[model samples]
Target: MANVENRGNGSYRLTVILGYDEKGTPIRERKTVKAKNMKEAKKLLTLFEAEILTGEYFKAEDKMTLNNFFPQWLEKHAKDTLSPDTLQNYISILQKRILPKYGHFKLEDIKTIHVVNFINDLKKNGQRLDGKDGKLSASSVLNCYKAFNNVLSCAYRWKLIKENPAIGAKPPNGKAKKSEVYSKEELSQLMQLLDDKPLFWKTLILLAISTGAREGEIAGLEWKHVDFEKGTIRIEQAITEIKGKGVQIKGTKTGKERTVSVPEKLLEMLKKMELTSRQDKWKVRDLWEWPDHFFIFGNEFGKPIRPDSIGQWWRRFTKKNDFKHIRFHDLRHTSATLLINEGVHAKVISERLGHADISTTMNIYGHVLEEADKTAASHFELFFKKMN
Candidate 1:
């Protein structure tokens, strides 16, 4: 039996007289309530009763700590549902940062103030969990907080803890700044560099820069996805590198598949590449030797090209050509920026990029639109000058 009463600290105290402890002595566990009033105390009592009914009321074991439950929750529940890449990230955070600090503590012992202390400790440790190199990214620190919060939420759900300590804890602030797009002169230089490269590589880079399709979407494509008659290409799948699991070909990033339009000149280029593929039988011999089906940018062995490989190629191309400070993903950024610069509407760009939301399109190219506005004003000024 359990009852809760006001303890005069503007908080309530919950007393539960259960049974004998490990040594057969009569046991009565007293827990101080953090709730501010009687109504919340009643709610806590009801929750405690539900725990009793379910036979899950743990008597504050020393071994059951944040470190114990965090890993277990991830391994038992989250592993299968989360993509392999996400699971790996969780594992890295747990092993590198979380376990080192809180591994020995008990779950019930960790309070809201303890959470604040832990975050402060992270900052004191030079913001580097590994104790080497520089501070963690703002995104990475927030992810750490979120991971801790999730485990606490699980604990509360299982009645292992009274409340989540991480609840209302401050996460890292500020947005990750977007990367800059290539200028007209830079784009011209890149195009000239592409002209010097092999036909297949050049076409792949050109299509990526032009359409802003993800490297995986571009690589996972097939000849059938291209509609020369309609001048469009369908995006249906993505290639991912799953840690401890190598690679996987999966559904589109946004789950739903969609089509994107291609320029007529690009269509002509793809047709030419197809003709070249047919002419050079040996070019596809290795891919054809395998049982793997159609792939747009398959390897020499005919398997679907990994997105990492595309990244590596981009890196090598950039490094060799002295085009540093740009990512392959920046090609997508370049595409959106170029279109916005040409006065295309945000909705049209959103559809072209297969983004699920118009807001996503606007977020990516908002800077470009500001420049577009400036360009429009400049044009208007020039027209007025001509009239004068």
Candidate 2:
């Protein structure tokens, strides 16, 4: 039941009885509306009651803000489900960007307009937090959008919100930067430079180029993962560093293991490296702290090498040699590009790279594939010309 009481000067208070509480007291919802007369007030009251019956009425008393709900969502929802790195990323985005803007807003009060405005604001004036001038990058804004959308999605799923406002909001279509890779000539030059370098640097750089494995994946490799007879390396794990948690070994990026064939030359190098490790083990038997673990790229103490150390070394190496500056991960891109140029099938390349699907391979290396396709067309054209 519902009623409207005239509260003077065209103002009316509409109240609806929304059933009983556990103590049998009637639960009521009240809204104040302004109308010209009693008849208009009655119509407003009817509409309010209809909204309640249809579940379209938003409860004003819920009072749960984003600030209040985020912790609950993190504890009951995101913590167990998301990866540690991913969870940390979400927390960072929320703390630094999303929460600061709309955290005080009641969860139910966040509408599509709020989300739209938030995204627009991010595009306009979202300054970098690193004391750098200029607005946030398109990708950074996109990340903020994703994190905000995910949180609201959870809220909607948990019935805290009637709908996810983010569903209706569109984020900026940020273009992914093209992957940089070294040319064949440049790779040859790099390989030559590696010859004068230490065995560890030589092996690590060659392994990255030959296998197209990530830095962490290479760091996570163990002697047991190598098969000398088969000339294959099992890529089962990766090292990820969590803030305040030090280094942690986790499964592959896609949570699936793969076996990759390596060059015979690389395998022979691995054999020599294995012999050196065995000798070192014998020399420092009592001093070996990680006696149980046998990382292929372990430090002098036999602990797995930090993945960051690989990048740091590459930077110094590139700077010293005055080589064409490119990121260390570009070696993986270089490997893929070299294979594509050799006319290897995309599926084989996809599998070797441990991508979840061939489409991902195509997406990342599409430009190389395009160039390969052009070269293939030219070859066919020349053959037809010779036939003529």
Candidate 3:
């Protein structure tokens, strides 16, 4: 039998008798449970009592604290499963934000209220780790919340915790800023400035805008993946920087290979690179035995260039040339937006962008589609003019 007593601070203390000790003295245990109301308190008390009766209750030694379990979770659950970038974020939150606050607390001790309070605190502080001085955006906080909630959800699914408290916690909703893209006029001006630029720079930017491929995908490209006859580039892998491992080639973002069509002009440009490549290959042949498959966007040393280096170059180029500024990723949006304006079918655009679903393409480029919708409606004006 168990007894529940109000702790007078919106909490209930559950008292239960386990058994008699060797001295015939009754063994007693008590847990202070936090709940929204008496009904929840009663339910928790009942559940705890049932677990004890069935010998399924976790002993003190068996119970894991948030700090202890996180490392185990990282090793067993996250290591091989999540992308290096994503796994790094999980580890960061566990060490910096989450573990610092809840490390000493057991998994079962954390409740919906605790999770909700943690989010509230994050919203209140809103600090960023990247050294940017601005307050953290709601969307950024929401991302952190998602990482924290995912761990709890995993524990719940593994039966380490009785319930996933995060499910009951409020999700952080934030205003989404539209992606900024270069206008067609701006894009044309930028192209003119690139006339004397290196072929790698020109080709990388052009491919990004034409194919809507990520920077990693562009940098990961090898000559073998590019088919001059087929006029297509197979995106099989991408090089990315992981936390501990530094830079390594990995699968595409979606973990699936996708083929993107190339314009004949772009294909011709690539074919011309082989002539320049052969001239450069002699310079490095004696120094190092480079990989047989050379990256299309390799450095002078016949090694793949890091995505960050390209971004840095873009920033410097835009500043020096006085060009309209946009992040490299915005080039992807430019491609999708231009396709929408040209009345390209959504499915075709989605496939070209290697989006898993048409909705993703539509959602990101919806503003352009809305304008196209108006253009579509205005087409009926010619028919109505005859009636007038």
Candidate 4:
């Protein structure tokens, strides 16, 4: 219950009498308000009344710590919306990083100062459970911070705290910048490095570079989704890694289907691949062995290949060639960077990449596009020496 009373000195007081704390002790809190007169005091009382009615009034029971509610919060709110991959990340951070630091404490026990100190602790912890140096990367710690903030945001929405303690905390400054794109010569060397790999995996790499499809999307490719006649490939599913299983097919990242145009060379390559695949039908018969079903890139025996398998294959190929260290994802970046460098617009690149946002495409490829302009100008300046 809440009530406001005039104190007769141009001031008013609002008091909330809570039912009881967890241990059955009565809890109460009060706030003072300055008012011109009884009329203003009455207005303030109305505001307090509204707040109390909506359960926004902070009673003593509301002062319980965040740790107590974390489990309930996860069970009730986060379980369904979070993807399996994302859920794993959250649990890993909570168990390894967050719980040991702040698990025993309540929400009110946490302060902005605690958040700042925790980030510093992450930087200096210097030892992990694996007995390896635990010097946390700036980007990883930033993600932890984001995860913490998201938890607190839920707390705020649930009215667990008066304000979010994790709000406004600065993210760690990243020490590493992303690397430059591969040059044509380097790209040629890398592709040549792939000559000895499985034909299907090689085709996967080639398609990734040419179409700028994500690794998972490429792994999920099915023949039905490909239109060799129109030279187009449609993105509808993704092959993702599951804990118990090697890989599982899931919905696309945006949950929307999109089509990308392939070049004539790629269409011809697919035709040759279809012929080659038909000749070797006994390889992946145990898995994905449906009759009349066609997979653009599948195991030798006709089963769908997992994304992890493709990633592992790519790693071996790169290591064997002693090529520059870059993730398979960089292949997508290489495609976009190459296209932008050759004067392709970001909009077209975004469409090919199946990005949900044009801004994302622009943000990534904008600098590469600018660099291309500089290179073109330099070449023109040297070539036309006597231009009037």
lDDT of 4: 0.76
Q: 1 or 2, which is superior by TM-score? A: 2
Which has the better lDDT: candidate 1, or candidate 3?
3
- Judged by TM-score, which candidate is best? 2
lDDT (Cα, tens digit) per residue for candidate 3, span 1-388: 6888888778999878888999998897778889888888999999889887865566677788888888778888888888877888778877888888988999999999998998888776436777766667888778778878888988877777878899999898865678888888988898899878988788888889899999888888888898888899998898897766666788888877888888987887888886687677777886533466578887666777788887899999999998888888888989998888889999999888878788987787777899998998888887788889
Q: What is the C-alpha lDDT profile of model 1 across 119-154, one tens digit per residue?
A: 666655377746587766767777777667766777
Who wins the lDDT comparison? Answer: 2
- Clashing residue pairs found in predicted model 4: 65-106, 65-107, 66-106, 66-107, 283-301, 284-301
For model 2, which pairs clash? none
lDDT of each: 0.76, 0.89, 0.83, 0.76
Off-target runs (Cα >4 Å) in candidate 4 are 1-54, 61-64, 125-130, 174-176, 254-256, 275-295, 300-303, 379-385
Candidate with the larger TM-score of 1 and 3: 3
- Evaluate residue 255 in candidate 3 and report its C-alpha lDDT on the 0 to 100 scale: 74
Q: Once superposed on the true structure, which residue ranges of model 3 sit more than 4 Å away at CA?
A: 1-49, 52-56, 286-292
Candidate 1's C-alpha runs over 4 A off are 1-63, 121-132, 157-159, 275-292, 377-388
Q: Give the candidates in order of TM-score, highest first.
A: 2, 3, 4, 1
TM-score of each: 0.76, 0.86, 0.84, 0.78
Q: State, as a TM-score between 0 and 1, how close model 3 is to the true structure.
A: 0.84
| Deviation from native of the Cα of residue 350 in model 1, angstroms | 2.1
Q: Select the stronger candidate by TM-score from 3 and 4.
A: 3
